[model samples]
Target: MITHRLVRTWEVLPSGGYSTAWAELTGRRLAARGRAVGLLPEPHWVTYTLDTGDDYVTSRLRVSVDTAGGTRTVDLRNDAGRWTVDGAYRPDLDGALDCDLGLCPLTNTMPVLRHDLHRGTGGGGSGPHDFLMAWVSVPDLAVSANRQTYTPLAPDGQGVGGPRASRVRYSSGEFQSDIEFDERGLVLDYPELATALTR
Candidate 1:
């Protein structure tokens, strides 16, 4: 039984692609389905479904990609901090709390919500928080473990003349960007990556 629902759309900056997602909240769990079309690296489209626990930690994910080579799919599950892909245990992703789907901004919401980073509290006092992520590659469905960090930035006053809109600095190795998020902790703008569309 779903108690709440939300929908969001984003425009992929570099490749001129677009994605739309619909999410449902039932009890303390959340489930979402999304589709994305892009031409980066190659021309392709992707569809995915995600389920998360009460804490916004990813529990299961399934992704399907379609390209000139046809379509391939991958299923991943996280149970008690342990991870499995395509029914095979992956110790490398054991402790990962979330899945960073390549080129998908929705994946960032979990960490932000969990740590209250959007409210400018969690990461502010404790500094940046680090996490191991189950990173999924686009159009390939390949999974790997990656390390990333999120640090809260001061409010930029883009919403309601208050801190309704927030920023978080996302870093993975040499790549870093200051991502702006809306009041509900959804990505509003990700420099050089994507931007939320008013739909």
Candidate 2:
């Protein structure tokens, strides 16, 4: 039962957004708890807990948010390849492979680093890997595993493995960013968002 801990500060980049999180990893399973306050353009307090296994191919996510509208809690999960939200199976999410909790990019580390992701290798971003993710939106408390894409980037000097460190761009709708991970597949930094490491 090997356990690892990590902490990261979340920001909105060049503005006044602040939050922090603590995460624990045991073997291939991960459990994380986090809180955010004063996230730019919106004033609210948000808290979340996320758990995953099999290299993040499956997950159970919970989140609560307090804002001018009110407070609400959301719970979601993906077992094997099946997805559920607030204890109900979602037929719309059939055949999804991952969960994107809209809260943090760290969750992206699980599949990008652990899966045998040769989807976009040497293709100049041609064959982008599409992850059918159980997506979550905190403030709205909406949950679904729509469609998201992860595209591998060229290698760079950083950690271990054949390419040392790796990069991947996560895209959904109009959202996208290049995320870097260490050799162990943990996120080193998420552009304009957060940086993380084992403690």
Taken over the whole model, the C-alpha lDDT of each candidate is: 0.85, 0.67
**Steric clash count of candidate 1:** 0
TM-score of each: 0.92, 0.77
What is the Å distance of residue 185 in model 1 from its true position?
Answer: 1.2
Model 2 RMSD, rounded to 1 decimal: 4.3
Per-residue alpha-carbon lDDT of candidate 2 for residues 15-120, written as tens digits (9 for 90 to 100): 2455566777788777778777665456778788888776655577788988887898988877776778888889899887666655565567666755534223
Candidate 1, 43-145: lDDT as tens digits: 9999999999878889999999999999999999999888999989999998899999988988888888788787775444548999999999897888999
In angstroms, the error of model 2 at 14 is: 10
Worst lDDT run of 10 residues, candidate 1, spans 154-163
- In candidate 1 the C-alpha lDDT for residue 131 amounts to 91
